[model samples]
Target: MTVTRFAPSPNGPLHLGHAWSAIVGHDRAKADGGEFLLRIEDIDGARSRADLADEFRRDLEWLRLDYREVAPQSQRVATYRDAADSLRAMGLLYPCRCTRAEIAAAATRMGPDGPVYPQTCLHRPIAPGPGVVWRLDVEQAADLCGQLTWTDERRGEQVARPELFGDVVLWRKDAPASYHLAATIDDAADGITCVTRGLDLFHATHIHRLLQALLGIEPPVWHHHALLVEADGRKLAKRRDAPALAERRLAGEDGRSVAAELRHGLLDTGISFADTLLLDA
Candidate 1:
């Protein structure tokens, strides 16, 4: 069965962007006679909130988006740990003691996420203690996997370049698994056939493709949608205080109407796609 998912973090209230992504996944699944699953990505211990997770359910109900719930990521740490263990057994994961500040100081190039890690700890001896992050050796993994590509529903075939991110962290000191590791493991474990998210995550698919190869998991087709941005043309972000959908509901706005407006690209600011930082398709 073709399965798509709408995975959201429980760190904040749902915004218009979240609603649009959920609607997109729901409609796609319905159209293909498949299933739309919901997964709560609350692996970040520092930011995740139980109350916010409850609000996520209410927001989805308000939007009338029904889905079968997959096991929450917070409860799946063991599964992720096991996957990491397997990768370690393959010699693809290595312990890194480099701190964030250290990497920032050493990095010379920037990728979509941030500074491309310079792999300072790739060959360094593993520290004899905890709090060590495990980074994937992208170059070695790519050499073993050889040329790889993935299908993007809109852009067609894309050659995988996992090295672009340069040895991304699979396991973190603060958390058992990083976003890239957890998302890939859950998607494959849950038998997801199609992955739908925003274009901001398009580059992430490259590293995911490599992980899927090394882990011997089935790869899913990707659909990267344009992100919803603010009137000022910056991407909508929680840090920037993007208006919450709950606030709109509190003001007596209909969820269906909001979904409709989002579908048609109708926003209060009337900004076009070009106005935003849309990357090349």
Candidate 2:
């Protein structure tokens, strides 16, 4: 049976972009006679709020999107820790103590996630101390796993090249696990058959495919859909002042109608669907 999930962080309210992603995952699961699941990605320390978490549930209910809610990432610290320990035992994990500014200054090239880490701390014999992030050695891991490939419903077959991301972080300095670690671990644990999200994270799948191989977790097929953007071409992001769905709902917009419009790629706000499909192609 196919299983799909909509995992949203509760640090901010859901926006139209989030709505589109969730609705697509829900519809895909329904079409396949499968189950849809909701996962609260609230693992960020201190930044994630219980109030915001409640709001996330309320917003989903307001849209009438049904799903089985899984335990939030906050409750799964031990699982991530164990996974990190396993990787460390294999010598594929390293301690990185570089600050953001240091990384920015050192990186000569850029990847999808800002400046690609230069792996400055990869060989540092420094003991795990304060502000240390756990990084996975992508080159060593790929060598161990040999060539890897993953499939996307929209883009077809893909050869995984995690090296583009350099040695990515598995456990963050501030959080129990990075998004890549937590999402990959939880998806496997929840038996998710398909991973659905926006195309901005399309490159992230390469790193995820590597994690699945390294962790011995079953990989899910991916769906990297287009992103919702404004007329000026700015992608919708809370930090970028994207309108929150709750704000619209409070202003008397019908949640179900909004969801329907999002599902059909229709929005009253003149939000353009940025075609990331060609890039994936």
Candidate 3:
């Protein structure tokens, strides 16, 4: 059976963009008679608010999106550590002591996320410690996997290029697992057949595909939908203080109507869907 998930971080209240993404995943799963799962990605340590996960459930209920809840990332730290240990045993992970400032000073080009690491500690014998992060050796991992690929529901086949982001971090000093490692493992653990998320993470899929290959996990088809943006063209984000869905629910607005409007490409006064659903080929 097809399975899809809407994984949200409970660092803040849910917004319209989040609701749209959840609806897409929920509806897609229902359309195919599949299971819809909700995952709370609350592994950001002190930044994650425990109460917000309940709030997220209420918001999804208000929006009429039903899903089977999964174990939050905070509860799966041991799994992430075991996955990291496996990678380390394969000689695919190395400890990096470089700080963000040091990497910024040494990096010459930008990758999909930000300044690429310059491999300052790649060959250095850095030990795993409180201040060190674990990074995957992308070159070696990709070589072992060899010519990997994944498919997007809308974009067709994509050749995996994990090297685009250089050696991405698998484990962080502060968090139990970096997003790439935790997400890749969680999807496989949940038996998710279809990964539904926004377009902003489209590039991150390359790294995820590589992780799936290295971990001997079955890959899932991807559906990266369009993001909801503001009139200024900036994507809606919680950090930017995007309007919260809870506020709307408290204002006596009908949740089903709002969801229908989003499906029809109509949103609140200032919110608009991206020009195109599919990214440019």
TM-score of each prediction: 0.94, 0.96, 0.97
- State the displacement of the C-alpha of residue 53, model 1, in Å, after optimal TM-score superposition: 1.0
Error of 3 at 5 (Å): 0.8
* Shift in Å, residue 242, candidate 2: 1.6
Q: Which ten residues in a row have the lowest lDDT in candidate 3?
A: 272-281
Please provide the root mean square deviation of candidate 1 (C-alpha atoms, Å): 1.9
Total backbone collisions for each predicted model: 0, 0, 0
- lDDT of each model, Cα atoms only? 0.84, 0.87, 0.90
Best by lDDT: 3
What ranking emerges by TM-score with the best candidate at the front? 3, 2, 1
lDDT per residue, candidate 2, 78-117, as tens digits? 9999999999999999998888899999999887777889
Mark the regions of model 1 whose C-alpha exceeds 4 Å error after superposition. Answer: 270-281
- Show pairs that collide, candidate 3: none
Per-model RMSD to reference: 1.9, 1.6, 1.6
State the number of backbone clashes in model 1: 0
